[model samples]
Target: MDYTALTEAISSKSYEKIAEMCDDLMLQGSTEGVVNNEDWPYAIHLLGHIYVDDINSARFVWKNVPRVVKENRPEVTAAWKIGQRLWTRDYAGVYEAIREFNGSPEAQSLVDSFSEVYTKRMFQLLRSAYSTISIQETALFLGMNEEDATKYVLQQGWSVDPASTMFTVKKQAIVTEQKLDPSKLQRLTEYVFHLEH
Candidate 1:
């Protein structure tokens, strides 16, 4: 398989697309015979799944990867480590794994993207779950130092209490308008018309 497009996707940091392509390859049974090597991009594919926070899919990919690839490529192993931490909900361990990764620049970029996405997700979860939370816990969740976490929260409109060292999260109420599917409505109308006739 020509991996030119996959390389371009990695260069552009299109991780979701990478995940889709990897899925399509597996679905087509194209990767079954392919040898794992520098060109196969198994690491990128594995990291792509992890990047999307799809731990189960990531595990699936890891299980199918050739043992030689897993043994030879530290980057691939590191990516799996991150996935393992995610699966166990060890949020701090996730950051530690990323910090310890000394992989190629391409894999490094994906790891960094995953870190940012995970941090944002945790922040959203925290905001929804807490009216006020300790700064220390916020830092742990965000994988940042206390001062940096404080600054990040403040920038997000969370107020800080100097005396208690707590942050008051400003949760925005999300208003979702219901959308109607025209095709579904049309199908229902046609069924009703046939029933009446």
Candidate 2:
């Protein structure tokens, strides 16, 4: 039995190496080694994490991985769920998952690494919630000093208020069409074939 591609690696539970192999193989643009293997679920799970910060890449892999691979693979499913929330910038969910994994000594290092992303995502949420909020408040909230928080916000593409140390979020206007009832629609032009005057 040939166990070269993913199964043997997965059976060994050497996920970090599997992730590295997936990267090296993906760079070659030849998926002959990874796809259609019995361990497709595990491979996809590893691939998604390899591009954890890249939401589009993670989703693209998920789409390509197909629905059939998700069956009976709880770990793969959980990994996909994590990638999805990470992609959607769901910091709460991400942090929860990180905390859940933190209990395992083996996974602690990986959890710590993922926590960095959670920290980044928390700030993103903060930036999103406030259209214009005091930088000092942000600094206080994130436990950073004024200057560092200001620099961080600015680096994240938020504008600083000239009058004070405030982070001003520039949100795009949302335009939506009002729904009109069909019965209430006004007919501006109508041709009368036969009208009783």
Residues 8-123 of candidate 1: C-alpha lDDT, one tens digit per residue: 89888887788878777655545467643444667778888888778899898888878788788888898888889999999889899989987888888888888888899999
TM-score, model 2 to reference:
0.43
List the global CA lDDT of all models.
Answer: 0.85, 0.57
User: Candidate 2: global Cα-lDDT?
Assistant: 0.57
**Pairs of residues at least 3 apart in sequence or in different chains that clash in candidate 2:** none
Q: Give the clash count for model 2.
A: 0
Worst lDDT 10-window in candidate 1: 30-39
Writing each residue's lDDT as its tens digit, candidate 2 over 25-122 gives 55444445434544443434444254356556556656665566667555555556667667765545655555554222323444455556556665
Instruction: List TM-scores for all candidates, in order.
Output: 0.83, 0.43
